[model samples]
Target: TVNELRRQRKLMEKLSMEDHLTGLPNRRAFFDCAERQVEFSKRKSEAMALLYLDLNDFKGVNDTLGHDVGDELLKSVGKRLSTVCRKSDLIARMGGDEFVYVLPSTGKKGSREAETRIHQAFEDPFSVKGRSLKLTASVGIAVFPDDGKTIRELLIVADEKMYENKEKLSRESKRVTIT
Candidate 1:
């Protein structure tokens, strides 16, 4: 029993920075690493970027289906997001259908490409419990030094931008519905 407990504890440590549900880095893990990266950028005078993302209509799925389905959807989204990012980039799930990407040594052009890739990743349908569901993610981007000097400030700006993007998406969705 002691050995098993130890093993479990080690596993948790390895995964401690990640969300157990989606297998994406948790906020703690993301921010810890991101802060270091920001400091490095500051020291080196290199560029960096932060991307904030949120799933639209995710709550509707959870309400219409169940938590199990909702969780599966989140996992799929996480996987797709990972596929979109570069090997050097960091993708983390902040919590509850929200995710972020930390782009180190990246410029505005690179950040734009990353954002576009992430958006394209969600273009396909997600299959859950034999059902094909469509979803979209709103992305907010903040460039390093250009947007803010520190990780905390960058994140705050990114989050604000994310909400603005989400609002745009909502308006588009409503327009389509009305049409």
Candidate 2:
């Protein structure tokens, strides 16, 4: 009886920690790990990076292809992100088309490398329901101490930068159209 109960508890704990769709860490689990990592980094005086990524034109996919296809795309994106990110790093879906990456002990070079890897991961088309769809993401990066001392502050800055990057892209596309 004790062993059975222990197994059930473990199952519940794992379920609580993972995203139902992507099987990646959920926001709660991610935040817990991120906070611990931040504290550790603070103690070691090491730099870390947090990246906020938003899928570009994700709403359009849902609008045109429907929710099923959108869900598939999201799952595929999550899988690819996991592959590109360091094994020690944590990638979590913050719901919808937004994802967060916690890169521990990552400096400027590692951050750029992670960014490049993430970009490259999306270069290949994702196949869903016998259809291949191209996708892109707007990424905002924040380094600890430089951007924020705390995880919450880092998230805020990263979110702002992500939106700013998306806005810049929008402006550039508009300029091209006007020209």
RMSD of each: 2.9, 3.6
lDDT of each residue in 91-135, candidate 2, tens digit only: 999899999999999977788788888989987788888788887
- Give all TM-scores, in the order shown: 0.91, 0.93
- What digit string (tens of lDDT, one per residue) describes model 1 on residues 17-92? 7799988889999989999999999999999999999888888888887889889989988888888888889999
Which structure among the candidates has the greatest TM-score? 2
Question: What is the number of backbone collisions in each predicted candidate, taken in the order shown?
Answer: 0, 0
Model 2 Cα shift for residue 143 (angstroms): 0.3
The whole-model lDDT of each prediction reads: 0.88, 0.88
Q: Flag regions of model 1 displaced more than 4 Å.
A: 1-9, 174-179
Clashing pairs in 2: none
